[model samples]
Target: MLVIGAGLAGTEAAWQVAQAGVRVRLVEMRPVRRSPAHHSGEFAELVCSNSFGALSSDRAAGLLQEELRRLGSLVIGTADQHAVPAGGALAVDRGRYSAALTAALEAHPLVTVERREQSELPGPNQITVLATGPLTADALAEQLRSFTGRDDCHFFDAASPIVEGESIDLGVAFRASRYDKGDADYINCPMDREQYLAFRTALLEAEQADLKDFEAESAHFFEGCLPIEELARRGEDTMRYGPLKPIGLWDPRWGDVNDREVRRANRAYAVVQLRQEDRDGRLWNLVGFQTNLKWGEQKRVLRLIPGLENAAFVRFGVMHRNTFLESPQLLDATLQFRQRSSLLAAGQITGTEGYAAAVAGGWLAGTNAARLARGLDPITLPPTTMVGALTHFVAEAPCGDGRGKGRFQPMPPNFGLLPDLPERIRDKRRRYGAYRDRALTDLATTLEQQGCAARTSSPHGQV
Candidate 1:
């Protein structure tokens, strides 16, 4: 069996195949060739922010991580082993995290890690899993396009900038989560309407990075991955309602809603959030601030936000070209290509966004690939599980083309993806918790029915 790419999806898929007692040849194109977003050959490298998002199971991303852990996910295992402190979020020391994953795969007896570019999908007699992520090699990407018979959909994705934590103006920024939920996990930079409007005006007028000639020029940015400035351009209040929403996020230091007197300053009109990027909290990522501003412009403009006046940037926000299949036309619920059962697709290529969503796709693809290699039917988990819901959605999500079910767009796991509960719960927290509980229950039953287990566990540690 073969898995192509060494991204989060590919590495996790390869590990799952090997753990299921199948030998896997994992191919990576780095060093020999590198994508615009990658800097090294490390397996599971995180080029953007290191966070896997909120730790509490009630959250969509956190619930996905919990599901992966419960299913013995190799990616989550390595992440946990190298975890850094980010309050209620899971973050990792980037170098250590990748090193640990690389070492484990290197030592896996059933796995062979190779450095080469594979430009074609496997022929019928062979089993191949494609987890090439968004920035797939152009040649292979072409091959995929031909196979799917659908012109690939194109989009612009962005990454947030990181700043030195010490450079943040603590006097202006306060540490807290919305409504004091969880430990104060974020550094909030409060801004009055005047300041927010000023920043918005500057963002609208700021210069954008030029797109490379070879990259697809698309007017559409995935709603979930829109650049901060793009959001700003949508409307004056679009950013406030989206990333900078300040409702329920009052700073106790200024708000009067303390134990007795309700007389502090009212909540800011808009807010910018910075999340810890490492265990030591030395680096902080500008949450939901992905952008395409030129480096100088980014530095000058971002510093306009409160608490960032003297900020020192460690990494500037960047926008990159991304490609995805019109999956509803070509894939089954298990991620198997409809025309070729032995060939499966995973990760961002299948239109699921976020790190956890990628891992979930890899898990399902790897599992079904192992079953195919063993002469068994490819198994699909119950739709009630986060894993099942995600895979099923990719296979059947709306597509406007005549070949698909409805309009297809990239998705991130959320309660809306799950089928409605039999009994509705009014409280948001309880409702989310109910969804989490039901998903886990359904997952256990699905695994039991499928007879899936860790036939062999991958060894984990720093290289």
Candidate 2:
């Protein structure tokens, strides 16, 4: 068995193949060559935020992580072992996490790590797993183009900013979760009407980072990860309705502040949320505030938030082009290439977003590849499960919007992709919890029917 690339998906695929008693050739071009987004020769380098989203099974990402852990995922296990203190998120110390993964892969006798550039397709008889991921090199990408017989569809992805936790003014910002449902895991900077308008105005006027690879007009940016300035341009109130929505939060310290500051007695007109970025709670990321603003302008404009007036930034936001395959038209639910049964693609390149989603693709692809090597029928997990829903969506969702030219971008895990329950449940959390229950039970049944292990490892997270 062969797995190309040593990223999260590639590493997981190699591990799975090795666990299946197969000798695997894991190809990685790092150290010898590099992608624009990666910094080290390490396997599973996380260029984005360290978080893997919420850790409870009631949420979509959390449920997906739960599923992967039950399947004995190396990436998820290593993440838990190196976890940082991200309030409700499964964040890790990136340095330690990547190091652990590299060491494990190197120690595996069934796995052989080869560091070189793989710019072309493998030979006819070779059963290969293409997990090169989104930051694929130009030559390999062109090779993929020939194999798929279609242009690889892609979008721009952005990373949110991280601020020094202590720099935020407590008198101006308050810690709270929406509706206080969970722990006070988020820091909120409130904005009144004037303040919100001013902030929006500045954001609109701020300069965007220049891009040389793709023209602005031809730039294919994911709608969910659009730059803050782009949202500001859409409308004066767009930011408020989106990221800045002040609903369900009330500031207790508002009355103690000077009345002359024009602070609202109730909820503010807009709010900026900062989520804990590390285990120690020293760093906080600006939630939903991914941007392409120039560095100097980012500091100047971000400070406009009431609580962030004196904020010290740990890291400014950055934007990168996220590449993906036109999966809906090219691949199946098992992530197998429709044209070639022996080859498969996984990770971000397959149009699945987020860490867990990428891992799910790797899990499915690796499992099927092992089955094929053993001369058994490959499995497509039932759509009721999170992994199945996401993989099926990638394979079946319409590439075109009704008007006819909108291509399949990327998809994150969410209940919207799951098959609806027989009975409607009005309460959102309860509804999601019910969905989680059904998926897990259904997953167990599917695994048993396929004669796979019911429990590979105790899950690192909970429902």
Candidate 3:
């Protein structure tokens, strides 16, 4: 079995295939070929935020993590082992995380890591899994599109900027996470009513990007990670409630909020938080500041922040070419191409967002590919699970079918999409717990029927 691309999805796919007792040739183009967001040649290199998101089980990210654990995800295992001090979020040192993953995959006896670009399509006899994520190289991506026969498959992607921590004036931007949560791990830039209005004006007037031919139509940004500029365009105060929320935490220099409440002299109308980027604490990333603005314009507008007057940019925020298949038109629930059952697609290319969902797709596709390779029956995860819900959503979405399913949109797993609980529990938390409990029990039963344990009971840390 061959897996193209050593990204999160590709790596997970390869690991699962190898675990299924199949030989895998895992191909990576890094060091030999590279993408804009990638700085390392290692597998599972985190391109955007280090945090996989909130760890609370009720949250989408948390529910997905729990599902992955139930299914014995290798990526989640690696992330947990290398986790940093991120409070409720699962953040990691990107360098160490990628290095650990690369080492583990290399040490696997059944898996062979190949450092070469796959510029062409695979022949019919071979069982190949295309987990080539969003930033897939041009030639290979074109080959994939040709094989899939779809034209509606791409959306733009962006990255936030990194700044030198020492250059930021502490006097202007105070160090404190939101609600004083998360161990003072974030630096807050307060925006007074006047300052926020000024910032909004500049952002609204900044030079905008021309839409690509593929992006000429209206497209939606993922709700959780909407671009900062897009948020600004929605309304002047939209961001204040969203990313720029300045709740909890009173600046000591300005006295406590209670002390100032009697007769307020000054107060922050909005705020921007920057998070530490490296262990050395030399750099910080603008949280939720992903953008597609021109580089020169980005510098001009971003510098308007209170503490960033003379900030030194270690790496400016960048926009990448994100592409995804019209899955409703191209793929099945198992991630197999509709026209070619033998060819399976996974990762962001399949239109699911977030690292966890991409890894889930890889696990599903890889397992099915191994089944095909060994002449065993293919298995599909039940739609009750987060992984299964994501898979089923893509396959059944009624977009581009000339039916009433509206426009095709990539989705992250949410409770709204999951099956309703048998009994209605009005409380959201209790309801989610019931859903999770039911999903796990079903998954265990399914795995047992197939003579497989969702996870091994052995002490092996390798997933």
Candidate 4:
């Protein structure tokens, strides 16, 4: 068995294959060749936020984490071990988590860690798992493009900027969720009309970073992950309608709630949300503010928003090339290429977004690759499960052109992706809880029927 790339998906895939008693060769091109976003050769390095999203079981991300735990996922298990204290979420010390994963993979006797680049696809008989993530090198990306027979196999993805929490003017910024829903998890920076207009003006006039030759040639940004400046260009009110809308949010410092008119008059024209990036609330990322602005411009323009005037930047927003397959037309739920069963793909490259979703793809592809090696039939998780719903969606979603030329986009896990409950439950919390319950029950039954239920034992213990 062979696996390419040592990212979250690749590391998890190699671990599963080796654990299945299959000798696997894992190749990584990091120090030898690094992506624009990456800063190290470490395996599973987190280039974006440290967070893995909400931790409530009824939530999509939380439920997926539970499922991975039940299936004994290495990536999630390692994350759990090195986890920092992120309230109601699983976040890790990025450096520690990556180092631990790299050490674990290197120590595995059945796993051969190779430090080099793979410019081409492996032979048909190799039974390869192509876990190379979104930042696939040009040579290999072109090879994949040819194999998939598609001209548009890539898109631009952006990362939001992080700011030091201490530098934020807490006196001006307030912590609250829209309509006071759930916990007061987000930091809100209220902006009146004058402030909003000024900020918009700054964003419009900001200097942007230059794209590489390849990226510049085909500058297509994914609709789901558009840059902040791109949204500004859409319309004067576009940013307000999208990320900066101020509906259902109220800051107590505005006035006494007893005076309804006074409260109503103080409503912000727009609001900038900041999500906590670390356990200690030391780092906060500007929500929905992904951008390609140059470093100086980012500091100059972003600080114009209230509360961020004296903000210290931890990391500036960046835009980079993200390559992915049109999985709806090319892959089966088992993650195997329809045209070449021996070759499997996983992670963001397979059109699945989010860190947990990437790990789910790795689990399926790795397990199936090992099964094939052992002369056993590969298996797919029940579609009722989050993992199953995601894999199935990628493989079976309709393509725009009947023959699969366009119209497939990357998907993040959500309750909507799961099959509806047998009976209606209008309460969102109950409905989500029902979905979680059904998924776990169905997953257990499927594993038992397939004679693989005992594989739930985790090397890092239960997550």
The regions of model 1 sitting more than 4 angstroms off are: 150-320, 402-406, 453-463
Tens-place lDDT per residue, model 1, 88-130, is 7888898999988888888999999899999888897789999
Please identify model 3 stretches exceeding 4 Å from their true place: 155-320, 401-405, 456-463
Candidate 3, residue 403: lDDT: 20
* TM-score: model 3 vs. ground truth: 0.65
**C-alpha local distance difference test of each model:** 0.80, 0.81, 0.76, 0.83
The candidate that wins on TM-score is 2
List, residue by residue over 327-347, the lDDT tens digit for candidate 2: 887898888888888898889
lDDT per residue, candidate 3, 162-193, as tens digits?
67786799989988655556688788888888
Candidate 4, position 55, lDDT: 69
In model 1, pairs of residues that clash are 85-279, 256-263, 256-264, 398-406, 398-407, 398-408, 399-406, 399-407
For model 4, where is the 10-residue window of minimal lDDT?
A: 454-463
Q: Which residue segments of model 2 deviate by more than 4 Å? A: 152-319, 401-404, 456-461
**Candidate 4: lDDT over CA atoms?**
0.83
Model 2 residue 263 lDDT score: 37
Candidate rank order under TM-score:
2, 4, 1, 3
Steric clash count of candidate 3: 1
C-alpha lDDT (0 to 100) for residue 253 of candidate 1: 76
The lowest-lDDT stretch of 10 consecutive residues in candidate 1 is 454-463
TM-score list, all predictions: 0.67, 0.69, 0.65, 0.68
